[model samples]
Target: MIKKEWILQKALEQFNERGYSEVGVRELARMLEISPGNLSYHFSKKEDILIALLEQFSARNSSFYEHYLTLSPTNAHFLELMEKIFNSQYEYRGVYIGNQYVRTELQSQDRFDYQSIATKRASTFQKIFQGLDAAGQLRVNGEDIAFLVAHITLFGRFWISEATLFTKFPDKNKTIRHYLFLLAKQLSLFATEQGKKSIEEFSRGMS
Candidate 1:
């Protein structure tokens, strides 16, 4: 039974790595070395598997962001957080962001947890911004800042996601990191010189 659960868990990972449209029941079962009927017993539809994937992803991300927020968020920490999120969501070859993009293209509501997943992530951003505001460390208003950071992060991820187009380049990893780092710098989008200096000061604590 536990093995079966592992099978399902891995399947979700694959679906997240791949997209719901690109993955199918037979392929998932093949990846797990199980028959289609057995896989169906666990997840009746591909959409059901996607829901599971998003649920697990949501829980993990929610917990991670909450814990980090408690640890005294600073600009450096925020930058790190942005980088991590980018790697998972918008990095080249990442399925999470890809699946999300595909889901948005699909009009069928039941196929994805579009709003719920997005909301959970946005709420985490809200919390972080609120914390910064309370600490008197934020130069920008929490509401507007949160909105900006969210879109900046997403856009950075979205931008770096096109690394595949540069496949002919010999230094793909180097190129990708260069772009990702540039995007990470957007963390300072709304900070004042004083606010920016304060953020720089926090870098000592980050390392």
Candidate 2:
């Protein structure tokens, strides 16, 4: 890997294993076996590395949203999408779980407009639900759609933090399945009969 990519990879690993506050740029240089000055050439502050990592995370989520837009919407398909979402959250657990520290450090940076990001995410969820409603998989009205979107956006953003508390060992697949169940259950409340059936089949397949 090139030096910049190498630095991000090592930094992500250390950040995920140890909380972001505990890791420093000098320690990252030591881990990369490079001089501190060289590391600074790529990322001057630890927050710079954090911003890069968050960019990567945002890109991955955008790709997933784009891909799903092309697929036929179904309850099963939505569940599958949730699985991918949870997996990505697990992969970047450090960022999601240590969100307080992240927010504190990046609050004044102005590099990321978190409110805008949240707005876009809610818009995406609206599209997904609208698609499902057209597909006859979901029976949701405009008011309920707003409610569901709000809860879903909240849950998706912070589920990792909550999961880490109850999970001792944190097996990726198991943690994903647990959260998926809760998400699927929430959807079932607004799902059509066909949607319920699709979810049932999906749940059975997961077992």
Candidate 3:
């Protein structure tokens, strides 16, 4: 029997190394040293493979949210969670870099709902912002909190793509750390004095 997990692992590596559209089933099969028919036995189409990959992404994101829900309302907790979230995103860089294209293909296949994913992300971030506001870490009022949540969500979604434009150095770990630092800096700008101190202390510890 074909091992689905092995196909996924190899596919993820290929997707990350080469652009998704550039890697066809034949190319993937050749890379894996398996016949295209063997891959087809497990995944009837490329969309099938992509859907499987997206399912893994969904599960990982759900796990992140579950752990995030357990965090105490503090700037330090938030920064730490930001680090985890960004690191996870970097692992799935293919998703961010070609999100629209992936979603479009998945939608065309009637196998994915991008809007639901987007809605869930918005709701999750809003809750995080609400927790921060309740803890007095956020200086913004309720109205601004909504915008701030959306702002951060947008940044997280597109940060990898943005990094690509100027990240000529190509150190993946350093890029992830830089983005996390940027996230903390953005939040610090809208933080209360106590929150700012917490963030500063967190930064010092990292350095």
**Per-residue lDDT for 176 in model 2?**
87
Sorted by lDDT, highest first, which candidate order results? 2, 3, 1
lDDT of 2 by residue, 1-207 (tens): 347877888887887788788898888888888889888888888888888888888889888888888899999888888788788878877765346888887787898677787789899999999999999999999998999998888888888888777653488888889889999999999999999999998999888
The estimated TM-scores of all candidates read 0.69, 0.94, 0.91
User: Which runs of model 2 end up more than 4 angstroms from their true locations?
Assistant: 166-169
- Give per-residue lDDT, candidate 1, residue 54: 56
**Candidate 2 global lDDT:** 0.84
Q: What lDDT score goes with residue 193 in model 2? A: 97
Clash counts per candidate, in order, are 0, 0, 0
Model 1, 1-207: lDDT tens digits are 536458656875674466456777898888888888888888887666656655555565566676677687565566656545545443223235444544554346565555666676667777777666666556567567667657765764455446544442235345545554564355456665655666565444433
lDDT of 3 by residue, 1-207 (tens): 669999998897877666577789998899889999999999987778888888887778778878878978878877877777777777776654245667567767667776788789888888888888788888777888788878877887788777666542357777877887888888988899989988888888766
Q: In terms of TM-score, which candidate is stronger, 1 or 2?
A: 2
Clashing residue pairs, candidate 2? none
